[model samples]
Target: MPQLQEPKLIAGNANMPLANAIARRMSMHRGKQVGLVDARVERFNDGEIFVEVFENVRGEDMFILQSTSNPANDNLMELLIMADALRRSSAARVTAVLPYFGYARQDRRTKARTPITAKLVANMLVGTGIERVLTMDLHAAQIQGFFDIPVDNLYASPIFALDIQTTFKKRMDELAIVSPDVGGVARARELAKRINSPLAIVDKRREKPGEIAEMTVIGNVKDKTCLIVDDICDTAGTLCKAAEVLIENGAKEVHSYITHGVLSGPAVERVTNSVMKSLVVTDSIAPTDAVKKAKNIRIVPTAPVFAQAILNIWSGTSVSSLFEADTLSPIYDGTYAAE
Candidate 1:
């Protein structure tokens, strides 16, 4: 068999800092210098998206790093158009690396006349020349089935577990891992297992999309430091309310580890005013100005993870091993040992 071509990385406007960080990590892995493909993605006066590639990509494996975060439509469109351009340019393979996949909450219809927008977005991606997808902590795992091509869904548990181990070193015996709601108990349990902490659940009744009717703590949390885990934190209404309820239930302190910080609307204000000691989120979605200024909100880098995944995919290796507990030691020290 012929040797596999070196992977080419292109980024959209959603999160350039993260894309650049991933590029840097990939460069370190390759030893010799590697950089993002020289490309221009911009808009015309009428708001039409335009893409131009400066270098040849013929027969090269291509990966587009774009997160469909806030202003979801524009970023999503940019990914599709970029993939189409690469396909026309005769690239061998095109994989979309979406750090934060928007419209994921609309994976299914909750009522009449509502569309499964997540599936629609998946169709749109496949309709473009995208051959595969690599994303982190999708809101719903079933979204993977929406695409005909291969989809690799990575988890943030390893990163969060390592951070928790470092932050609460002497307080492990006093820690209680919490799920913000029943739907997230599995995610919370995974982290609890990794850290050998007890598990708790926040039983909440959602009156509507952004409102909560009642909430109760499920397990023992008295005098214990509680850590809530979830996939997304939009508006932060539910997260803040859960923190309040946990405090009222006699928890010592409340913190959170969320995969995607889609902190839109009044999320920053609510988090600031809430009882949470701190809210930790991944760099899946780029932070806003307000988020940057918030004292209690911290961001964990996912670039190393994505960079390793891209390299593994291009080399036909196992992506799941990236999350194995034993193999993640390098992540804690800001280094990755490439295989």
Candidate 2:
């Protein structure tokens, strides 16, 4: 087989720190220093986005690391425009590496006249010449079908499981993994299975968006240390509320392992005052100043995972193997050795 071209990683303003970290980790995996491609992504006075790749990427394998987080429209536009530029510049392939895929919650129409914005976003990316997509813990799994190109949805369960084991090693028998709502039971179950712990579900009735009416714990969490698992913690209304209910339902302590921390609005304030022992989220979205300073909020770096996945994709190896139980332990333990 012919040798693959060295990957060219670029980034927009969505999450530069994560992009940089991924580059550094990938460098370690390759036994050399690999840096990001110098690219300019800016806006005009009238708010028009502009993109210019300073380095030559002709016939190169390109990956644009961008998260469609807060200021979603602007960040998404940056990714689209950047992809367009790379395509026009004759890049052999362009993969969109979205740490946090925005508009993913709108995967389906709940009411009449509602639009599936997730599909729309997928269309937009494909239209912009994105050949593949790499995202983490999509709000809905079906969102992957929206793209005609290859979509690799990475899971955070492995990372969370390792952290949970290390943090609660002595109390493993007392742990109970929880899903904040019915829709997330699968996600919670996966983590529970990974940790060999019992599973619980928070059955909540939604009054409306960002509002919870009532919540009930489906399984016995009495005196157990509960760990709530969810995809996105937007506004944190559901997450904080779930923790409160878990504590009230006799859980000894409540913590959360969320994939994307789209902690918008009063999320930080709510989490700060909530009954949760801690809220652990991945570094998919760049943490705001408030998030960074929040006492109980912790961020787990995903650079190692992403770097390994990218390497696997480039080398025709199996990306899914990275999450296999046998292989997951070393990936986050700082070893990051390939299987």
Residue ranges of candidate 2 with Cα displaced over 4 Å: 334-339
In the order shown, what is each candidate's alpha-carbon RMSD?
2.3, 2.1
* C-alpha local distance difference test of each model: 0.91, 0.90
> What is the C-alpha lDDT profile of model 1 across 1-339, one tens digit per residue?
345678889999999999999999888888866688999999999999999999999999999999999899999999999999999999999999999999999999899999999999999999998999999999989999999999999999998887887788778899999999999888899899998999999999987877799998999999999999999999999999999999999999999999999998999999999999999999999999899999999998998889889989988899999887666767445332222
Q: Per-residue alpha-carbon lDDT of model 2 for 1-339, expressed as tens digits?
A: 465689889999999999999999899889988899998999899999999889999999999999999899999999999999999999999999998999998999899999999999999999999998988998999899999999999999988877887788888999999988889989999999988999999998978976678888899999999999998888888888888888888999999999998898999999999999899999999999999999999998899889989887777788888777567666666432222
Candidate 2 clashing pairs, residues 3+ apart or interchain: none
TM-score of 2: 0.97
Error of 2 at 153 (Å): 0.7
What's the residue-level lDDT of 204 in candidate 1?
A: 90
